[model samples]
Target: MRFDISGHYLLLQAFDRTGRKVFGGEWHGDEAFARDTEDPSGVSGERRNIQDLIKTLAASAEPHNAILASDADEEEHQAASDALHQINRELGQLKERLATLPHVTGSWLADHEAFKRRTDIESKLFEAFRSGDLDLQVGPNEIVQWRTWSRQPDFKVLFSMSCVIVPRSHAGQRRRGPAFIQLAAFEKWLCRFAGAATGTEELTPEAQLEIWLREKIKGPKEFSKPVYRAHALEEIPELSARAFDRVWDNVVPKNWKRRGRHGS
Candidate 1:
């Protein structure tokens, strides 16, 4: 739906889920206004009009020179995501070939080396987590770890990651988060070893690991699928508030809410 997000938020009371607003606000002389509809092509048309307007201005200035244009950080992330895909595709193909191979040979050894290097990239990238790794053992379940790390001197944090390594026979099913998240490992080494960015035909280890973590280590829903459902928001609102506050600074609660009855 089209919106004039300028001025104050002209909040929509109850918009039709199926309805879309394409033309909004006053149309200038020959210019068209937005139309509202939930049609599949409607939003695309609205966006295309915006894009055309942007293109007219972009000719004179760089792509992101306009106020409405995306920031460098957003573009950087998009580039990284694209890089992740191209590298992993080759890894998938190699895994398929390895599955089909029967016996060991010189060529097989070379292929094995390729596999080892791929895993090593994942390992080395995440080696920093070792220093503050903690084993949080739960009864008869997969192991969980709380990794402690500090970036600047003032800020310290504990990040959680779990793992379950599987043999080749179970490689299809056994996937988990990246090995080195404990150490801030994924960032710096990523660009160096990333195959997708290289334009090299071979699979990139960095890209492969990205895919690996995505498929293996999902949200808590994916992690605890068999045993549980999602937790209530009230259960950890404070933690959630802290995470949100880091981005917005406004969401952080001022003073704790005292608990118990008797007007406590």
Candidate 2:
């Protein structure tokens, strides 16, 4: 099990007594984390460091007794839930306080200076960090997984923020190899989409490699959107044969596979 935080920013995985994955999730802040990633947030450096501890704990495969593993699983689940709840509550309080301020009306005209301030305030509120990064400070002894958060616009309003984690792992694998494989599959299908034929002919060094789309792409007859890409990849058999060596090289420890397996 692994936690995919802030999209691909971080991943946390845990295993149970029988080497079974127990818990996996993702965490990301609202505006702060997103803006920080695109830009930078010096303030969150200390908080991000907690990720190192989580990585260490997950890699250590100390055999877990049945009861101990169960207890640990329960503890982690409760901890994650409680932390999310606390964040929501804090954001709610902040919203109430901000709402007390008088609402200022501004000009609709873009050239007006008041209009500029009004637009700026609106943008900031939309991109404001609601209940995400701030609530998830690094705990001294535990990994806190953040589930959701909100952003403040104007005063008392609360907006629901959401994103998706694409499932990329195949059965029995706990890494992102599937994502890369999917991309490769898309590349292959894209070639056909652009009327490009696959061949064994030697290519020139100057040939550019990029997924191209034709001006008149008569996509799969059934649908109009990009869902056909998935269908096309599914029809191909070679995807399964594609090795996940790249993923393993980045994630697995050098020592774990080189030496004999360590067991209890």
TM-score of each: 0.19, 0.15
Using TM-score as the measure, the top candidate is 1
- The per-prediction CA RMSD against the true structure, in angstroms, equals 30.1, 30.3
CA lDDT of every candidate: 0.29, 0.27
For model 2, the run of ten residues with the poorest summed lDDT: 14-23
Q: Supply every candidate's count of residue pairs whose N, Cα or C atoms clash at under 3 angstroms.
A: 16, 3
Candidate 1 runs further than 4 Å off: 1-107, 132-162, 165-185, 188-264
Point to the candidate with the largest lDDT: 1
Among all windows of 10 consecutive residues in model 1, the one with the lowest summed lDDT is 9-18
lDDT at position 247, candidate 1: 20
* Candidate 2 Cα deviation (angstroms), residue 208: 31
